[model samples]
Each structure stands twice: as C-alpha cells, then as structure tokens.
Target: MWKNEAEPSLLEILRKITELKLFPLPEYLSIITKRSNEEFEEDDSEDERDNLIDAWDEALKSSFKQLEKYADYISDNSSFGTHQGVKGLEFLRVMVILDDEEARGFLFSYEKLFGAKVLT
Candidate 1:
C-alpha cells in the first residue's frame, strides 16, 4: 500500500502502473504521461528498459502480497478495484457514484456512511 502512494519519480510511477496492469491508464493518458519532453536526443536501450519494467512488476506483486488484508474491502459494485490499482492506489476511500438503485430512502444512509453531502 505504501509503495502505491510512495513518492516515486514520474517515470517510476508509470513503470509501477505497467507492472500492475500491462497497460494501465487510458491510451491518451498513457501517451501524455509517458512521453518525454527533452532537449537532448536520447538513445533507446531496449535491455535496460525491459529490466526496469520487470523489476517494477516484481516489486508490485510483492507489495500486493503484503497488503493482502484489504483486498476484499471494496464491494464488487464499486469501481475502485482492479481499475485504478495501476499507478498509485488510494485505499480506504471509494467513490460511491450514484446509480438507479439508490432511491431517496437510501440517501441518508449513504450520507452517513460516506459523510457526503447528499442533497436529498
């Protein structure tokens, strides 16, 4: 869990994301976050890059094992899991996006559960 929120460099964050899910963010976001904006021409080194990616994958898997306790905390109906574990994961917090199942009677319960301002 700590590693997910660790202050790694930008590139390292992307690499950790790749480690979690082969390709983490949406295509557009990935392109924007990964592209390099440099003045000098850098050579491409396939071996080194591959090694780093592999290292990240191993590190992530290890971290996952350590934080195994909170795996089932999020309900299946929630959109927090497997979806955003890519880059930096934020646990203990979930976005209860409104849905049709949420009728007026359920508003107060949600408000109490999440301390959210439900205007119902």
Candidate 2:
C-alpha cells in the first residue's frame, strides 16, 4: 500500500491496541512464567528507558509471538522496508541493491555520499 493508505492502517492498529487494555510487558511475562511453571530471573532494574523494555512496551504488549508473525507478513508482502518498520529485526545475511537514479523518495541519496552533490 502507498503512504496514504499505510498511515491510516497503522493508526487503526494502534487504536485497537489501546482498546485491548493489554497488560504491561513485565506483568504479561510474569503471567506467562506462571502458566508455563518455569523458573525465570527477575529484573531488579526499574529503568523505563531501556531499549528492550521500550521494544516490549511498543510491540509485545499483548503477545510474545505476535511480532514474529507480523514481521513475516511484512517481509512476504511489502515491496520496501523502512528503517522504523524493520526495527528489532535480525538477519544472518542481507544484500542491498541500490540505484539512486530510480529512488522514489528523498530520504537518502548516493550523490551526497559520493561527494557529487554538496549539502546546502
């Protein structure tokens, strides 16, 4: 989908998330631990700014497995991946093909990188 359609779709997902009233990361993980009857270490730190904490705060608030499935869907369906969209993803190997002439967006340009175009 184009930017016009994608933005509204994402906003709708966020709205649904708010309506779900899902438990916070720690609380949800604790519940899972109890359900699985598995011993787990408790994090004593209360730092909210931690990266892992922030990731769980955004993506995994409702379910641990949802993000993987969502990422797979995006990988299979989307034509291009943005930096924000691919956050927290890991891959063993990646190959990028760049042709600045055909680039549709102005987010990045190889001309600047190669000293052919100077910044204003």
Candidate 3:
C-alpha cells in the first residue's frame, strides 16, 4: 500500500492494518482509564474507548510484526531507507561489509553519486 507514496500518515498505516488484518483490533470493549475523583467515578460497560494508550500498544506490536515479517522486502544493500516508508521500523537489518576498503570505497562512491546527503 505504501509503494508509491512519499510519506504515509499514521491513519493510512492503521487503515492498511485493517485492510490486511495484520493484528486486528481487540475483540473486547477497550478500557477507558481515567483518574478517579470525588465528582468522577469509573464506569465499566460496553464501550470501546482506548484513549490511545491501549491502541498504542496494539499498534506497536502490529507494526513491529509487519516490519519483521517483511524486513527483506523493506531493506536493500544500497539504500537502507525504503521508499515505501516503513514507519517506526528501526534496526531493520545488520550487515557486515567485511572489507574496510570496500566500505570506504562505497562511501566515496555514494558521496559522489548522491553528494554526501544521506538518502532518507
């Protein structure tokens, strides 16, 4: 879904999650946590109010799984940054160039090609 876009929004990612049914929303009425006060009392009933905290946890797990499952597709040798934009995906891969000279040559080549500006 993020193949061509510049940078997809969080809502767009969430929509993709639903479309893919990657992790899926919970099957219960999400709790609405609140600070109890003299005038305010906690009430539990049938309502799906996550207030983001719950939603955040769910989103992270889902997002991480998506990154991990699709790491190969999301990363490349030349450009670590995926144009498809896997938001919140960090440490996508670990690589050993295995040759200091090769690594230096690569940097010099990329600097000449891309003018020292790291591709984002």
Candidate 4:
C-alpha cells in the first residue's frame, strides 16, 4: 500500500495526529512497513548501497526511540503495522490498507469485505 497512491492519505493522518496533539503527543503512534530496507534495495553501487543502508538504520533507530518514548501509552492505544507483522496482536484501532486495484480477489474485494450497502 505504501507504493500505491494511498501514501498521501496515510501521511495526512500522521500529520493530523501530530498537529492535533492526539494521544499525549508521543504515545499511541507507530509506523511499520511491509518490507525492510534490504528487501527494497535494488541495483546500486557499493557506496550508494552503504549510504542507503545507513539512512535506513537511522530511520529505524528513530522509530524505535519514538516507540520507547510512548511505551506506557501503547498498552491500550493503537499502532500502525503491516498485516504480516501484526498477527496474534489486537488493537483498539486497526486500519487495514487494502488497495482497490491490488486486492481484487474474492476475499479481498471491497464488495466482499464490506458489503454493497456499506460501500454506498
């Protein structure tokens, strides 16, 4: 979903959460991607790859710090995670990202997941 057009909306939600001072400013907020940096790395020079890896490491560290900062609030609050990573966990608010074009199967279709009445 991150690669899709829904990224803007996702960023907007994060901005609103920060701007509105929601959930104690630092708590109940997290972002997880479906794939890691290594998985995303394509063809690149050694130096370029190293730089990219470093940047990804820094970002991961920052995310970890944010989670630690809000460790207390997370017990009953919400978190953003990929479906694969969130298995066996439950949240008060679970926002699933299902791209209309990407999720076309019977099980994934909007019509099946959310009936026609709800869609309208």
Candidate 5:
C-alpha cells in the first residue's frame, strides 16, 4: 500500500494500518483519526500531531527481527556509537553529527540547544 505513493497522508496510513490489522494499533479509532481535521488551524499543534502519527506509522512498518539483525551486524562490524553510549570512551578520531529530526526520546533536546525551542 505504501510502495507506489511518493507520499501518503495520515488517512492513507491509518487505512493501511487497519487493513494490515497490525496489533496494538487502534484499529477502531482509525475511523475517528482518519476523519478530516475540520478545525484545522495554522499552528504547531497540527504539525506535532502529524509528526507523532508519522512516527507510529514508520515504526509499525519496520521489522523488529530485521532491526535486531542489523543491530548485531553493526555491533560486530562498525565503530558507530550513540552520544550517551560513547561517553567516557575515547577514539583515535571523532566526528559529531546532530540530527534532531531523527532523534527520539526525552534524554536530550537538540531543539533547545539549536534555539528551535525555548527552555521552559
């Protein structure tokens, strides 16, 4: 369902999720969420909501077994390390790259560091 489209909307993703019956997703609430946002407004809330939904959709489509296999391969073959994971360890050469968009979890906020968001 996702292969042909260059980009798919939230409604389309919800339908695909329902069709696949992916466990733990709200199959019944697809009816509610897939409905058009009649109260649409020009604000960050909508964008934030879309980001969360997109994250869920992407996670659902990923294969856990494949991810584990890749993790094992990276552990065996690569020196790649996460920021916190690499702490206290030294390497011959170090390079740092910051990618806030792909960063998940609440450990650190690159948004605040880069001034995209203000500290509360």
Candidate 6:
C-alpha cells in the first residue's frame, strides 16, 4: 500500500487525470488495506470468515470490471505494494518505499541498506 501521507497526492494525481477526460471513470475503485496479523487472528470465527469471503468476492468482481475498462493502463503501470504483499512475485522494476516506520524495522535497517547514518 502507498504511505498514508502519499494517499492525498495520489488522489490529486488521479483527479487531474480524470479531468483530462482521456479515459472513462471506473465504475468502482476500492482500496483494500492489508490486515495486520493480530486483526486477522481475532476474526477467526466461521461467521467472520464468511463475511470476509463475501466482501472479497465483491471486491474481486469490481476489480475485474475496472481492469476491463483500463487494461492498457493496468498493464503499463507498475503496481505499488508492501514487501510482504509482493512475495514470490517478479517484476521488471520495483520501487520499495522505506519510510521512517519501516526504516526502524529489524528486517531492514536504513543505515545498513543505504550505507548512510539514519538521523533518527
């Protein structure tokens, strides 16, 4: 997912593009947030699973319709996702977003990764 602060900028960019009228607006645009492990574990009941499954099904249908409308754009543009989300996937190019929160993680030390001291 894009950083929370970057969401506004992304929306503005989308708004500008839509105003240009180069393409039709999608019938649906859903942003599904990645659930934390703790949250997922908490919803372990069968009823909760069923509800989540139904929601996912609806989302998938909407996504397919959107893809049909903008197949070219989808194919050309790079997908933005968290590291865990892109596991086992391969792409010609990938840009990793390492903000302050991610920088402090044990898996990726900013200083070690970039060979520069982290100011924080």
Name the candidate that leads on TM-score: 5
Model 5's lDDT to the true fold?
A: 0.50
Give the C-alpha miss distance for residue 88 in model 1, angstroms.
32
Per-residue lDDT tens digits for candidate 4, residues 9-111, read: 3324454555565754332233223333464353234554555444543444333224443443344342322244344456666645545576544333433
TM-score of each: 0.21, 0.23, 0.23, 0.20, 0.27, 0.24
Q: What lDDT is reached at residue 96 by model 3? A: 31
* Model 1, TM vs. native: 0.21
Q: Where does model 5 exceed 4 Å of error?
A: 3-14, 19-24, 27-33, 37-79, 83-120
Give the Cα lDDT of each candidate: 0.42, 0.43, 0.39, 0.40, 0.50, 0.42
- Model 2 lDDT tens row, 1-120: 235543233223443444465543345433333332132123434645456544533443333233433455347653334453333457755554445787666776544432335645
Q: RMSDs, each prediction?
A: 14.8, 13.6, 13.7, 13.1, 11.9, 12.8
CA shift of 44, model 6, Å: 26
Error of 4 at 86 (Å): 20
Residue pairs of candidate 5 with colliding backbone atoms: none
- Residues 79-109 of candidate 5 have per-residue lDDT tens digits of 3334664443467556555576767646666
* Candidate 2 displacement at residue 97 in angstroms: 1.6
Q: Score residue 97 of candidate 3 by CA lDDT.
A: 25
TM-score of 3: 0.23
